[model samples]
Target: MYRMYDVVIVGGGPSGATLARLIDQSKSVLIIEKTDEKSISKLCGGLIAPDAQRMLGKFGLFLPKKVLVDPQMFYVESYDLETKNKQRYQRFYLNINRKDFDNWLLKLVDRNVSISRNTKYLSHEYSGDSITIQIEKNGKRDFVESKILVGADGSQSQVRRKTFNDFRYITKYISIQSEIVGGVILPCYEVYFDRGLTDFYGWTIPKNGTNIIGIALQGKDAREKYERYLKNVLGNNFQEVSRRSTVIIRPRRLNDHKTDKDNRVFLIGEAAGFISPSSAEGLSYAFRSAEALAASINSGKNTGKDYRKRSLRIKFNLFMKNIKSIFMYTKFLRNLIFKLGIRKL
Candidate 1:
């Protein structure tokens, strides 16, 4: 006979780890993580914005110096490649090593919460009152039973794909990032807008001694566009250290944010389309959604209904972000803002 856990969370990212940390200690919880500590480098810009800081404060968490990277940014330098327009906007961001940050969060989880590292969640089946999950680790397959299943996976969430299959209407972009060792370090974050390359945008963020050149694009020519931008920016002078790619979701409408299915299974973080459409920032959303879901579960009431109610504020926030994306992405409106020098420091 298999022991049934109170909760089984797939994907041990920020949302999953946070949920494990915040959920009722009496409940038996298991977290399935695909990557180990050494191989947990996620494809993210690693910039912690003010919203994420606020979430950390709420959790009574403090950042250690080991997680921070060098050359902290204080502002953003916006550029229009097509029009040659430039503007500097003040924005505070905490530069961090994403892998370290994620590992730190994982460490905060209670030792009682079983974390299966280097484990892959294959599928799940629901019976009368419990859900059975199939997972693989090091060529060995095993099964686990749970009263509740949570998909904290990510944009390409296996749990969400197997369960809800919702949020397909939300737009997805391919984000390509290349880390270069040799480049001129800028004091501010560099943002580039060129409609010819991509409908989204490109950016250059300076790390300790390296610089990350990244761009968001769609269609078959994504790599080609990213290569073009790399050539334009680095100009064959910098040594490319590494290249990473991932899918970024942009939720445009209110209906795109779906958090629960059937009161037993739930979604959180980017798996539930909680990312910002305008800024592509999801850390704060991840933290908030995980907290809300934990609260809903701990309440021991209608989990799904409570989760939906708790998520209304997040939905409203993303809705406002969608409205901002219009002014930020629309060519005419963006140019108008640039021309008028709105909010430029």
Candidate 2:
């Protein structure tokens, strides 16, 4: 007999794990995670917003002090490479260690929730009111059937590709982050905006003991831009550090849920392109999307329709932010906007 699950969630990030925790315990749910360790390393700034704190509180998931690095009233310093001008703005956010934060969320999941680590979703096929999914583990293949399939597997989700092959997604930006060693500590976050350096933005976020320097751009020469930005920031005293790069996706349409001929499937987190267009923030969106997805299922509604409705506010905000970002492409407008000191985040 084939193994069975009422719901199968691919990817064990904030979205996947939270969805599992919100699911009814009586349901036979399975989470397929690619990482073997709970606290897997990830490339992110790991800043939690004030709104995120309330969201976590609603779920009864309180982040311990250990998971948080430090709380600070952060000032964002924006640099214009074209005119060599700098402007400062303040925004309060809590910095955290991505590894520890993820581990904390993972621990909150009920022990009854079945989690298969070191597992990768291969492919899936619909058959007789169920979907048969193929997964790989330890060089071995296994099969499982699920009534509802969820693709929470990041931007480049294998589950989304295999299940929602026709989902229109645009790869908008490429982000590269490097761990800085023996770097000077700064009291606030820094951002660099230069069309020549990158079309998007370059940021330096202070961590517990070190700093994370990264850049997001819209062209094919991401590595070159990243290196140039690093050199510009560090001058001749720049040192080599470990770096990682990943693609950021943006859905062409947020309200549409046409993924081939399947409606029993759902996509959340980066798989559905819930990232912010301006800030490149996804953690908050991931958590919120997971909550929306879980609530829809528990209420006996169409997951896709419910998710589309639930994400309207987020999509609208992203759309407006993208419009605002257009002004940032031009140096004059960007400088003016910074000079005006608009507090809206």
Candidate 3:
């Protein structure tokens, strides 16, 4: 007989973990994570925006001293390659190690919530009113039945592939990041705008005592473009200590969360393509979407309807982001905006 669970969430990242924490303890929740351990480094800039902090605060989560680096005032520095103009602004944001942050979130889950590390969700099938998921661990396979199935896997979500099978639902972009140790310390984070690089942007974020630099783009020669931009910035002093790559999901549908009503399958986080189109910041969306999902399940409402209603603000903001991206990428226009002594971006 297959083990039964009230809710089975695939992927134990922020969205899955947050969802598990928000769900009532009366419900049996199982989080299956492919990683063998909780201390895996995710390819991210590790910058936590104020909105994400606010959401975490609602859940009584504060960045522990061990997990948070020294509180350094954030500064936004943008360089315009077209006119060789630089603009800087004072901003506020916190940085934390993603590996540490994720582990901390996992620990916050209700003790009753079952967590299975090193387990992979192979596939799923719907029968009657329940869903049966095929999972693997240690060269062995098992099946778990759940009333509701949630997919929080990631950009290349297997759950998404199995359910939607639609390639155009969400657009994917390639992102590469490198951690540079023993580099020149900067008091503020920096962003570079170069048409020669990615269509989006490149960033340099200071975390702890090291610098993390990355570029995200939709082009085939993303790495080649990144290298050219790096050469322009470092002038030969660039030395990467470690490198990682990941895909960023850009969901075409900002208003509706993907759900299979008959199959009881739901998607949140990157699996649902909940990510910022401009900044590529996902922590806020992950937490918000998970909260919405939890609320929908708890209220026993139409999950898709609740999710869409709850995400209204996010959808509007994303549309604005799309508008901002247009002017932000233009050479002369961006330089003019920066020269106007306005660095709010």
Taking the candidates one at a time, how many backbone clashes does each contain?
A: 0, 0, 0
Q: Which regions in candidate 2 have their CA more than 4 angstroms from the true location?
A: 38-40, 70-73, 166-169, 182-185, 250-261
Candidate 1 C-alpha error for residue 313, in Å: 0.7
Off by over 4 Å in 3: 182-185, 252-263
- Give the winner by TM-score: 1
Question: By descending lDDT, how would the candidates be arranged?
Answer: 1, 3, 2
lDDT of 2 by residue, 133-205 (tens): 9999999999999998898888787877776564444646778888886545366788888888766788888
* Candidate 2 accuracy as lDDT: 0.77
Model number with the top lDDT: 1
Candidate 1 per-residue lDDT, tens place, 187-303, comes to 668988988998788889988878888999999988888888887766777899889899888777777788888788899999998998888999999999999999999999999
Better of 2 and 3 by TM-score: 3
TM-score of each: 0.96, 0.91, 0.93
| Candidate 3 residue lDDT tens string, 1-345 | 888998999999999999999988888999999985545677888888877888888878778876776546577777876568988888777877778888888898989999999999999998777899999999899999999999999777788888887646566778888888644546576888877666678888877777888777778788787777666766577578888888876654543345444538888887777777777778888898899889888877876677668767766776777777777887877888977987665
Better of 2 and 3 by lDDT: 3
lDDT of 3: 0.79
Candidate 2 has which clashing residue pairs, if any?
A: none
Taking every candidate in turn, the Cα RMSD to the unseen true structure, in Å, is 1.5, 2.4, 2.1
